[model samples]
Target: MEHRHLGHSGLMISEVTYGNWLTHGELVDGDRATACVRAALDAGITTFDTADVYAQGAAEELLGTALAGERRSALVIASKVCLPTGSGPNDRGLSRKHIVESCEASLRRLRTDYLDLYQAHRFDETTPLEETLIAFDDLVRQGKVLYLGVSEWTAPQIDAALTLVKDLGLRSRIVSNQPQYNMLWRVIEPEIVPLCLREGIGQLAFQPLAQGVLSGKYRPGQEPPAGSRATAGGRAPTFIGRVLGTPLLERVQDLVPLAADHGMSAAQLAIAWVLAQPGVSSVVAGATRPEQVTENAAAAGRPLDEAARKKVDEVLGDLVDRDPAKTAQMMAVKPAWRTA
Candidate 1:
């Protein structure tokens, strides 16, 4: 329920944000999605994060329907652009054309005049950074966007964008950065976290439960439970399945007892761990049902004492300190490079 300043911006977001990544159109129907949004609002989650490509834009339409007639000023709505929406060459990326068109489309879908936070979903190396920044600045000047942010950007890319903002005296500032952070994926700590802290860019962490791995829903040597995301054949790709299988499940099993020792569910403990990190403005978690909203919000206030925090660090420390070399090599050959 606690609120935190969204970077250097005047906007303040709830410590726990409701994100519509996998659960919006994939797991929850229109009615269930509406109930989940209501649950999040009741639990004091004022920020709702989604993307243009999530469930191919069905998520935004569903959220728009859910928030109809509600007090718009009471909430912070964030959505991202980039990622291909079609087969056309200009269908995606941070080009000025796509950014502008996508923003208008998102506004129409969300039924909102302006977005509280408009983020670039990924770095578009092909698009000139100056062009992208100027486009975002134009959005701010036009009153269509309150602030600008980026998701899944490397530290250098963020620095470059900020530099461009300063050089051009752009109206928009890069106030927040969204990245995947969880017990299973602590890769951001080594460089991205420190850079955000130094630059005053708020960190909005997504996938805090590692796609439900940290929730202990998937056990080793057993099929994913019915109705679970992993159980759905087409939901997760082959590589994700391999990553979430036995080796990671073993780690989750080890951490579950640690979570219980602290009187919390694995989901809560995992989210608390992300919030404990420096520069984290909010942690975005998705929920299929109303009760999951309550559980996720509870992590905001659960005081992870020094002892518990250190214990989690000890358990996950080695896994967190990974060499980027292997990752780079994989990116070179992986067909799923776009997903990363």
Candidate 2:
């Protein structure tokens, strides 16, 4: 697989990374999860991304076991902070206490001493940015984390943090921002991409296939395929179901012929499209089966050329969601002010 430098950092990462979001302990058990990870290793995927909140932290344990016995230097493992892991006032956020404690927990779960990339799952607006930045700098100083990153942060949030790092003389700077990017989800294009590019922060995009909608598996009028993410129920209904409508599905269907012309699967076509975007360092793909692992890994070296990318845009047209406002999480409401 081809590798590229992650932003301005010297560390090189695979163009296509293996990410375990909903698959590890939720959908598959130990043996099955290990097989998929082994498949990724066989396909030459050196980078793996996960979060401490995934499956109540079981995902990290599973990934740790799956990556056992390999040379740790050959891997780039990333985990996130800032998400509430428990129902305590001090159990979450990017506060110094939470960041330090979460890093320790993640290190134990990943069965590693240091993580190549430590990411904040989201912007913790309640906490002072200095608190989070200082904590991350301490981790780097302590040799617990090699690099820093953030996920789903707005352009202003990222810029503010980067400016703080520079002005405060912090040792580690943010290198990447993880966001949802796909044919249908273009929310990061207008502002986030440009600012990140200007700041030399690469993008490690998740949901590159729009949660499998761009795979052409969901027909325009037909019910979602049994056992697919669209039909997986639970939170899947809210997250993946939005892209399963008739118009979007019909537009996605146009990618099938394009993938056929290139001798690639519809999923690969979707991934290839995301990699063609500027500042996208890696496309974090999820897979349940070994063949799925192999299929996505092949997209690493093969990028969608200019013509193919244009064709996809032409077919998608106004159906893409490019509103910068869409990046805000509805659930992230600030607490009400209390008079002393």
Candidate 3:
């Protein structure tokens, strides 16, 4: 793996970072999780991304235990907050109380005193932007957080937060913004990418494989393979299935031969595509097994040639569905929880 600076921050992160979204608590045991983490480290992936809400925080605890020894300092660790952990009204959002307490809890789970990067999982409409900005600044002042970031925030929301940070004279800076980006999802390109490029904020793209859809695993006519994430009843979630179903699978089939021509798996090709884009500092990909981590890490240096890039753009451009009705449906059911 190769290292890149995260936005304007002095911290350097691996181009391919490990993510514990499905395997930590749901699919793999602690031992397996340790093996995967070890595989990532051996492959030179120095950054790991997790969140408090992933499997109710079991993922973070598992990762902390896996990296407990001499390997700890050899990596950069990041975790997110703001998603609901319980049914209580106070259990979620980016309120000052939730933000402060969530950081403490995440630190405990990760067995660390400070985080390399702490991100607000989503925008909190209820809380005043100033209040949230001040709270984040306080974390930096207390030496508990080295940097702050936002996930899934629109351009205006990010602008407002930056303006608030300046108005309050806070020492903190928004160094990065994490968003979902892939061949199947180019929604961020129209505005978010341009904004980040202009503002000097780095982008850490998540779900670069479109939740494994671009991996060429799910065919249009066949049911999802047994033991695969999409088939794991509650694991795949309702919305994900609806979004990446038959129509998307058909689109993925068109890209398989292109991937084969490059001697890459569809997953690696998708990851490489995201890495090739401008302003992309790093890409966060989840792994279920040790080999999966190793495979994703290989995409770090596999730059796509112009012909391959053009082929991808032409194929995806023709298939992308930007229908108003589809967009409206997605916006309507989007989880209220913050994501990055």
Candidate 4:
């Protein structure tokens, strides 16, 4: 229910954003997806995030249907571009051609004429940064996208974009970043966080539960729970590799009593941990059920105190991924996004 400003901008977003990455119109039924979105709204979540590449665009359509009749002025809707939507070379990247076309398509799919925030899904090294920035500026000037953001971009990439915008006298600049951040994944901590803080960009974190690994449902030695993401067939399983071992599971188990002590679930604890980090504007949590949505929304605005955070650090000693080089990969672009 608590809202935070997206970076230094005037726009505000709910602390816990409802995101349908692999759930809506993909892993779950349409009814379930709608119910989860309703649950998020009932819990006072006004921010909804989806990507064009999620479920091949079905996710955006499902989210649009779910939020249909809600007050658009009272909500903050966000979507992303720069992903391969088809086989054509123009189907992806942050090029001017793709960005403009993708924004129009996203608006149609989201059932909204203007996006509260439009983000680059990932950096496109092949495309000239000027082309992408100009395209984003064009959208901003046309009143299609209110704010700009980038996901999975490194510190240098962000800095370079900001510098270019300043040098070229462009109006559009990055306000937020969407990165995979959670209890087990601290890859953005060392370099990206400092740079973003300095650059006035806030973190709209994704996978705050470590793709359900921190949900405490995945036992160390036991088989992944039936129908769980780890057991399901999709790209969600791909990111679950980092935390599937017994060592991490055992540490998670140790945190259970800690969660009980705090009167929260393991999932809530995971969410709280991410929100406590500096520069985090919101934690985008995914849900398959209505109850899960409500449960996660409760983690908003309530972060652990210094003592509790220190205890968590001791429990997860040396397990965090802090390497700056691991911030991004070439999944979206052939050779990674940062050209500098």
Best by lDDT: 4
Each model's lDDT comes to 0.83, 0.86, 0.82, 0.87
Deviation from native of the Cα of residue 234 in model 3, angstroms: 3.6
| lDDT per residue as tens, model 4, 197-226 | 988899999988877878888887899889
TM-score of every candidate relative to the true structure: 0.92, 0.95, 0.92, 0.95
> Which lDDT tens digits does candidate 3 get at residues 1-340?
7889998678899999898876688777678999999999899999999999988989999999998884556778999988898888978999999999989999999999888899988888898888888889999999998889988888778888888888889999899998877776666677777788887788889888767778888888898777677766447544356456565577678888998999899899999998989889999998877898999999998888889988887776644532322221344543221122
lDDT of 1 by residue, 178-271 (tens): 9877765655677777788888899999888877778888898898888776765435434245356565676677888988988889999999
Off by over 4 Å in 1: 233-242, 324-340
Point out where model 3 deviates above 4 Å: 237-239, 321-340
lDDT of 1: 0.83
RMSD values, in order shown: 3.2, 5.1, 3.7, 3.9
The TM-score of candidate 4 is: 0.95
| CA lDDT for candidate 3 | 0.82
The 10 consecutive residues of candidate 2 with the worst lDDT sum are: 331-340
Q: Report clash pairs, candidate 3.
A: none
Candidate 4 weakest ten by summed lDDT:
330-339
